[model samples]
Target: MMYKHFRHGDLLKQWAEQAEARIAPRIREIEKRVEFHQWRLLEAYRQTGVSEQHLSSSTGYGYDDMGREALEEIVARVFGAEAALLRPHITSGTHAIAACLFGVLRPGEELLYITGPPYDTLTQVIGEEQDGTGSLADYGIGYQAVDLTPEGKVDWPAVQKAIRPQTRCIAIQRSRGYSERASFSVEAIGEMVEKVRRLCPDAIVFVDNCYGEFVEDQEPSHVGADLIAGSLIKNPGGGLAKSGGYIVGRKKWVDRAASRLIAPGILAEGGATYGYLRDFYQGFFLAPHVVGEALKGALFASAVLEAAGFETTPRYDEPRTDLIQLIRLQDPKRLIAFCQGIQAASPVDARFLPEPSPMPGYEDPVIMAAGTFVQGASIELSADGPLRPPYLAYLQGGLTAAHVKIGVLTALDRMLTHSPSESAKLER
Candidate 1:
């Protein structure tokens, strides 16, 4: 019973009922809509196709530059942002975030991670707590985190207390894809941002929107957030993007981020003009349907896993527009194996894989990859080991129903085989 929480079962049920109540209409329509659009996206993938513009491909930058420019134009118009940037060269979400963070925050000002202590790769980019030696620490800017509520809502009171005169900007994750429990709601974040605006009118509100884009009926910016950052390799990729991330919102932040794109006199539009163009186009084309499917996988995963006698965060069938699903294993070993099992079930080669290691070189080495059909986005069926007091395996996204079913089935099957004791304990 994914719904069973032992002592918290009733509480979980109450929460689920409330969530269902909130999104009843939308959830009701998603299933059929998602199925229809999925077939269309798969057909599109078979056509125009995708490639990393910045990678070591035989097709150089000049190869299809004109076609690429048209795509960027389409992307700029899709989201109501002043400008957009894209890159197939970058491999991960953190790299894109770093490009935006260091580009926007100055050396003298403090940057508050209002919603998070941040994803693991952040330590390398901004420095770590032990010595505070990352970008912010080494560069003289301060770093602070405002923990979320027990339900995973932003602690507004804490945010009020944490902001200082020197606080340059406040950062939070738009989707709690990485969260063990409560994901911050879009409406809640907007309300909180309005509060922050009242406190420090000058401070910027930045959102790291990894798994939340396209899935939400409303975006962080719709709530007046200064900037929203995330990559295309997830939901925004439309199950079609080969690779990329983006930062969109106000002009000041957009231009500043553009200024940070390296090479001194070099232009920012070089890589982005194409990669972003392609990913953005593909994203919208497949977004509604694909994300809906991913949500279904998350829903099914939560329900089935809970039924199998495990404690799941966000309790399956709980109100979630995003695709993330978390199952607590408690034991680190089981957590690692759980992640490994998810990876093994990926469409790509499973043999050349590494165990669910902490993201090497960073404090949190939890391994995860996007499970897509065409080396597609990982929003569906990607799993990672979380570093915490009690380890957990955080899973999210499924581009197709089949992908979701296969990946999740593989994960549960492995749990039954290698981690039977853990499964038995959950059921007990």
Candidate 2:
């Protein structure tokens, strides 16, 4: 009966029903992960004695802020890390990752990415070529990347060959970002960490844990990563954190990253919470459940889109390590229309249509449909991608599965009505 309110056609409705039936087992699997993570986080909160007093805000110097310290302890306990830095001062995931990189590597040392080039925003941070900007390369730090094999697995042989005396950091990006490759599972990351340790025992194994948090039973820190960083606005924010980022790992590395975030002496000792502590603590507590909802939405999108003849990575039944559901629309118009539909379903700014435009830190024009409460929050339903070949649309995040279902089905309706060829293919 609720379906009657939407503009979906009879055929589209039938296809949706079939997709839901096919993905029911997978949905149950995601629920299991949610339950496990929820209990795990609850235990962390209890062990850390999270109380109302620990949710208060800090002022000015923020020195001896018990709430700030407690929250960091909770994050560290949940992630199985020696320490954690949770601060609003660190603006984004890229910033957190950059701090970790700058904190660990000296001027002569190098950072090697085993999972190929990182997300687009990081290209500048790594400074593939030394520009006048203060990128890692500008500071005399070296960077190298080993591409994944054709099968989308780590190039172990290439990784072995790429190691040098100055290689001080081995970085792994757990999510696929905008690429078509599969996201690395926690087990796979552990394997990479073990091999990297064998090749360079002292090398810091870092993971960019952006959209990959809470999707797995154990985090990369639980495996063998020496350091990991992510944006609070992504999975870990639980759609509640207004703004922030987190870095967790070995105490020494976390302390170094804190130093990079603030100053040497103020490492994890400064930065006022400014009334965001309640949101951060509550958001973290709700993250596991919220991430589970996003995962379900991703699965549903994969099933529906794949049935509609669009090529989708990590098919509905596949194991997921992140929230991204990539759809290759093969045409720019359809890509735009897809994002428009997602925006139309959004709770905020739905009246505005998204357009492709140049954004800083990216090489190509990008179209983003993020009508979220928090600016640029991917934990809420959003779709975005570059305006380039294959016209891929990367759909991520939904606070609720019903919202994703309506949004994606609406997108399918819009695309089918606009493209006769697409409708004809579905008809056949």
Candidate 3:
């Protein structure tokens, strides 16, 4: 009956059913993790004593805004950090990360990326090409990177050699952004922190924590990271926060980052919530369960898509450190059709076709299918990728497993109809 409403073919329906049966055990594993994190978050809220008074908003200057302060404290406690900076002023994950980098490192200091080059958007922020648009390089800050080994693991020897006297900040990206490598787990990050501390004792260990929140039982902050940053729209927002970002870490580091967000002397004391406090608090409180739902959707998509004859990273049964599910479509047409199907199944903008277009921060033309209630919120069901070799499609987020099933089945149907060759491959 549901298939008839969505117009999915019988073959696709059968495939989905079989995939669901095969992944039932794995889904149960994710549910257990969800329960653990949900309890942890609930305890954080209780310990913080969140109440109706803390939900109120504040106006200009935002002096003594109890709600904002309490929400930040709750977030910091949940993430196992000494302090936190939660603000609508920090626009994106990239912005939050930039604030941390600029806040901690001085003009003469250097930033070393140990995991590899960060996400595409950060390339400009680091001024790798030096366009002089007020990047770190423009401000006299230097940058260096240690590439991951051929097998996609951290190159420890290279990392040791890369550290220098000027290296003030050591950055690790937990998510595999537009890359074929696996996302780093929190345990792996702990090992990295230990090694970094031994190699460069004074260097700041900063993690780009976007898309990786609530995926594990513990956060990077708990694993000896000096600082961590992420966007609210990605995972911690729980699909409700309109816009915001968070930075959590050592008290001094968080204070420095806060100074960058709101000028010094008034650091962390000025930004008004303007009625967004309730969303921020409630969104965070619900984040763990919401992340669990997204993880289930990701698993369902992986199992169904892989069964339909496509390559997927971190197969359905593999351990997950982030919500992203990378599907290798191998053809531009297949990629477009996949995105179109996802868009067509979207609760919003279902009739509009998504095309590959040049986005501001990315180098290649990127195609995205996001019909979320909040603009560009990845915590809702969406798929996107760059138009390049292998033509990998990156799928992430769903408020519910049912929605993800519909979207993925619709995508498979589109792909099967678009290419007879692919359909034959599926049949065989």
Candidate 4:
């Protein structure tokens, strides 16, 4: 409402008001959970006593680095894990996950994705495709997957059948990734852990925890996961961290991931912080509130778009465990227009229009609107989707609920008034 450059300002305002009213109660409940986690995180930091001395880097072996060790302790405490590894060298969520996979599995051992195939970037890592990339398959590891049922729930019988004697680990993606299915909840994940343990007593259960942190009172590790991994620039970074990722879980498993992250001999003893300590600490401190805002935005967007006849996953009133809001536009041109509109509402790149084009590690052309200080930061306002069938747009993150509301409203307006036919013509 502050900016009047977009069309249907009056209609958008009216919808926003109604959407706010509808979601107010849920937002209040979410605030309480946010407060609880914030207190827990603050207590963890307090117990660790993070100081300026601990913030500096230690090169070479990086042995006895107080800040590095303390940060790991704080992260472990927050996630209810025996140990944790938070590092700038860890890179993206994919890298963190790859470390865990490589650290735990060996040649001839299998990695089973019980929650179906993971995000596109992981297809190469899991050896689902050979793209000249070094993957688990390239190293002689094996892979398997069990798709979800039509109702979007885990196919438990199929899972039991799929687990093999050589299965070394069972990977469950907490978030839905790019799928239309709902993200797994902590309670559900806990049940899954029990079932898997009953079937495969010794199989390590690893949860790919990207986009699912700080949104709930309990984490996957708290619910009996052997290992969990996520990106710092996603839910936990609070829009301040430049780049990093974290892995937390059983001490032995985390140790293995650390070994893979650097080297078997060096492990967590190496890898300098490189001046990312202060931002990482502060970003984690502010994460709870930032996550609440993003969750509120997702709920609001779901409410508004579903009412407008678009198919949105996890309806506004439904329980949420992640920040993604998938809107099925069902039209390629509409999807393009929606992304462009979201970019226009961005604070950073408001003037630039997004177009579908080839991006690395993706099968189809993808269009993205990332108006973040840190490139590809999902914790900030951004919208992106693969340009293919189903024509869905994955909308995630907003530093504040107000920012999300404005951007989502602007996108809806553009979708309604903008000519998809004209956009389609341009596609030629």
Which run of 10 residues does model 1 get worst, by summed lDDT?
54-63
Clashes of each: 20, 0, 0, 0
Candidate 3 shows a clash count of 0
Worst 10 residues of 2 by lDDT: 1-10
Candidate number that wins on lDDT, 2 or 3: 2
lDDT for each candidate structure: 0.65, 0.91, 0.91, 0.88
Q: Model 3 Cα displacement at 71 (Å)?
A: 0.8
Extract clashing residue pairs from model 4.
Answer: none
- Note each model's CA RMSD in angstroms: 7.1, 1.2, 1.2, 3.1
- Per-residue lDDT tens digits of candidate 3, residues 51-129? 8999999999999999999888888888999999998878999999999998998888899999889999998888954
lDDT of 4: 0.88
Give the Cα error of residue 250 in candidate 1, in Å.
Answer: 1.3
Please give the lDDT score at residue 244 for candidate 2: 95
Q: How well is each residue in 63-148 modelled by candidate 4, as lDDT tens digits?
A: 78788889899999999999999988877999999999999999889999888988988877877444456789887788988999
